[model samples]
Target: MTRETVGIAMNGVTGRMGYRQHLLRSILAIRDQGGLALPDGRTVWPEPILVGRNAEKIEALATRHGLDKWTTSLDEALADPSVTVYFDAQVTQARVPAITRAIEAGKHIYTEKPTAETLDDAISLARIADAAGIKHGVVQDKLFLPGLLKLKRLVDSSFFGRILSVRGEFGYWVFEGDWQPAQRPSWNYRAEDGGGIILDMFPHWRYVLDHIIAPVRSVYAEARTDIPTRWDEQGREYKATADDAAYALFELEGGIVASLNSSWTTRVNREELVEFQIDGTHGSAVAGLRNCKAQHRAATPKPVWNPDIPATEDFLAQWQEVPDNAVMDNGFKVQWEMFLAHLVADAPYSHDLWAGARGVQLAELGAQSWREGRKVAVPELDRTGK
Candidate 1:
């Protein structure tokens, strides 16, 4: 069987998420695994051209990855007809312009989430891509996680007859730069750099709820700036203008209520950094990044209120663990393979630019809800081409 190659011009590979998730773990991993196999027997390999502003850094990464292509100029890469697809993982503020150029150049586009800093920009890009008839997608990596997959299976199989409510907790204590060097980039604390807990996470919450559970109709959010001051990479003090924490409630289509808390200031007490507990009429399930546990209505134990007496039943122990019944791979890689296949084979790709635009809209509305201290409605997004 002949192995066809798909050339991907990868921008913003110098950043952490771009470097680790998209470049190394996904695109490179796909190449390492001998490409994706099609039913017709042709295999497609992804050939990546690393694009960044730093020539030396790009060159270094290209060499490290044993790649033949590296470029400081984006236009140089864009001009080349061989580069069939363009992937962006740049900062939020820079996404729109680059994506527009890529779309204008007639390249299929895939980008990291919060597709644009503004919801309108995201929608405009979606419209452009629709008109251009180019394949487009946004990173919704959480959907492919093992735990979420298990949860999806349960929902699909009607194990949960009718989901009533959902509670999601996602957070970690980020170190203050003064004592321990901050794990996240210094730019994350500045609103000017397009950094906020709500912006970073609400899109994820939107898609997670819409896909796994039900479509969200409205959101009530409260965003907070917990740590006002933080040290930068140089140990210099800087003011954090962005919200570090956000608490939100989502109203889904089927009368399902979802509450989510996202914070960089919180400490972990659960099995994973992110966890979701969904309650249905027949059962309830709690899912983390890699594992899920469930308890059916039939298995529910009755426990009387006890403050004076010692604890009777071990409540947490009653939930049965869900077995890993399916093969799971790195979430980002799985999505990338799907996107590549979408480009070549014209395979079904639902997570397109319209989905990305809707994510942006939800984030925008979430901020609106936070600022106004009221619930904001989310109308159904018109998927222009799809």
Candidate 2:
């Protein structure tokens, strides 16, 4: 069968995620592997053009990927008739303008999550993309993680019958940029640049909870800027006006309670940077980024609290490590391949702009909950392009 080569104009290719995940890992790797195979005995290949501000960086990325198409001008790339899709991995503050322009150019759009800093902007962008009649998607990479997939299986199979509650522990201590350079970009730490843990990650949790666990009816949150100041890559200290940590409690539609704690200040001592523990009436499962462990009713262990005694082995040994079921790719890469497949094969993609907008709405409401010291109800979007 003939493969459809979709022309993808990639903006913000010089950034860390853009360079590694979208360009080298997903697009170029797929092209290198003879394109992505579809279920219907066809393949979808991507023809990607790197777009960035730095000429040297663009050339270097192009050379590294063995591609001659590279551009510093977004306008030039948008004007090109061959580019049917526009992908943005730009900074949070810069994303709306570029994506808005892309929609105006009649290009299908895909971009990184936390679509905008504000809910209104996210909704507006969704409206614009729908009006343009273009396919749109946001990167919700966690849905494709192997561990999470296993958890989804258990949920679907009723292994966790009548889920009682969920606990999400996510954090890693970020360096102060003095002893070691910060891993993330400088803009990520600045509030003016649309940076904050609530804004950045709540969107992710929203989708994960809504799609996997339960639809959140309302949220109550408290936030803090644990690290008030940090040095940048250029050795300049900047005051952080945004919160570095967020503790939130969610009330789901079915009276299921979930708690999510996201922070940049906590030291990592657990299984992974992100871990989800789901407890049900029949059984329980704990999933980390790389692995999952389950305890069925039959295998469940009884325990009693005793201050004078050592911890019992019953609970310790009850968890059985779930076998790895599928070979895993980088989380971002999986979503990228899926997006390409959605475009070329007309496959159904769940992480559309409406989903993205919902994420933004969650973040916005989370902030409101924090400020008002009250629970904020989440509203569903109108996905009919109305």
Candidate 3:
């Protein structure tokens, strides 16, 4: 039995998403499982080298994981012939250059989303990877999310026939960095660092709508900076120049409209940070982070607006929770395993660079629409095989 071990260099392993998703949950967890099963009765394991900018931090992570391979030098890691795959979870501003360099070095790539801040940059990277004839992927983690997956199943099975529209609500009150030390990086609140809810999140929506329901043809959006100023850990105040909230309207190719509200300033009462409601001709379903509930035509509520009458109860009771069908894992980790399989075992994987570029395109267009107060047309990509 031929056992294949693919060497992967993981960049930005010090960050929250990088450490939890890419390293501990994906690589280490897969290692613990003795790697993934292959089609030919073989096993494919990932040999990962954690890469970052700090020696002590990387050393500590390596020590905690009982892995000796780590480095602060990206060029050195990329030059290593054994490192066949390059994964980036670096900050948004740093991703394109790093991934481009890795691609030039002939490494297959996988990285977290908003692959590049601009549509042009994302397309350039996609073109580079295609021309290089190397495998590439992006982290569209939301598609693998259990709740969203369940929702997709309903759509696929025609449970929600003749889909009408979708409404998305995503956000939470992020603590002031000075008082509570924000859970996300300070850079996430700064515009210069490629930060903003619109850019960070709309990409997820673009793919979700495209993959699950329909492709977006145009977008109209309005964005705002609700928190104009925030204090850092040092008790120094900084003027925030990025939008903390965005409300967008999308026109899908199939005439299914979608309305999305993304904000970091709002309080959440939902099951997860993100929630989606789909209304169709036959039924409607609501999905949160870990659960999905639906009401078919047979279960649809009958109601009339009456000042004194109590709301109908049967429809609420009929909303059924979707059962968990697969073993639960971190959403990010699920995508990582798929990426590794695609690289090492020739397993089919979506969320490739072109898909990622489309995400960037949506974000860029959304921002353009907000800035100009006009609808933005999404350009089609040339998906012809290279």
Candidate 4:
């Protein structure tokens, strides 16, 4: 069997999501597993060239990982023709220019969501990448989660006949830096720094709803900054200008109404940090990150509402657990493997830069809806970035 290697210039690996999920879990995991196998009896290995703003951190990361290639200069990293793909996980404000530079250098693009701070810029990047004729994709890892995979299977099997509506709840309490250190970076709460729950999470909901249920046609949302002040990593107090919570109602095609509540301040009372319940005429399923429970129409529990009486029903126990027929891998690693296959073998990949742009569009429109106090229509975008 023959083996091939592809160089990936990974920027912003020093960041939390970048380092933990992409670098360690996905890329390094693939490398440790003897690379990605192709259908043609060949294996493709990933050679990561770590890139970052801090030279000391970059060098230390490379040394810790036992990898030699790293650089503080974007130009220097992109200058190497062997680096066929440029992956970005940088902060929102820094993404557009960095991605543009990488595109200009004729490299395949892969990056985190909200590809650009604005919808226009996101569309521009999509158009530019398309015009350059390169393979591109955005991280839509949630779609690959075990729970969502089961939901997809149920949908494919027509389990939810004529789906009607969906409800999603996602959030966890983030401590105020004063009493306890904030788990997230302070930048995530500053509006000027491109921090907001609507911007951060609406993209995720957009993809999940669009792919699993139906294409989102409209959205009505309200955003709020529940915690107005928070201390930064340096123990300095800062005003939280960004919205910490968002409640949204999305109207999708096929008359599906999806209501999602996203908040960083709310305490999680459910089984997982995030969960989505899809209800239809024939059946309904609640899906978290790893577990999914379904309640068919035949198994639905019915009870008469009576005030001043103790309830006898155990509602939670009514649903049956969905079995994992196969082993589940890390969602990030799964997407990474698929991307590699698409790059080397010309496999089908739908989550391109344009799809990423669609996510940005949804977030922009969600914010607009919040501002205007009305539902905003989501127009379809074509290849020309219209």
The TM-score of predicted model 2 comes to 0.97
- Please provide, for model 1 over 1-386, each residue's C-alpha lDDT reduced to its tens digit, 9 standing for 90 to 100: 97888889999999999999999999999888899987778899999999999989999999998999989888999998889999999988889999999999999999999898787788899998999988999999999999999999889989888899999999999988999999898888899999998889999998999999999999999999999999999999999999999999999998999999999999999999999999999999999999999999999888888799999888889999999986899999999989888887888899988898888888999999999999999998886522
| lDDT assessment of candidate 3 | 0.88
Candidate that beats the other on lDDT, 2 or 3, i.e. the better one: 2
Model 2, position 178, has a per-residue lDDT of 88
Output candidate 3 Cα RMSD: 1.8
Q: Who wins the TM-score comparison?
A: 4
Model 4 quality (TM-score): 0.99
- Tens digits of per-residue lDDT, candidate 2, 207-243, equal 8998888898899999999888899889999998888
Give the per-residue lDDT of model 3 (tens digit) for 117-161.
Answer: 988888889999999999999998888888899999999999988
Off by over 4 Å in 2: 384-386
Which ranking of candidates, highest lDDT first?
Answer: 4, 1, 2, 3
The residue pairs that clash in candidate 1, if any, are none
Local accuracy by lDDT, each model: 0.92, 0.88, 0.88, 0.94
lDDT value for model 4: 0.94
* TM-scores, each model vs. reference: 0.98, 0.97, 0.96, 0.99
Residue 241 of model 1: what lDDT?
Answer: 98
* Number of clashes recorded per candidate: 0, 0, 0, 0
- When superposed on Cα atoms, how far off is each prediction in RMSD? 1.3, 1.5, 1.8, 0.9
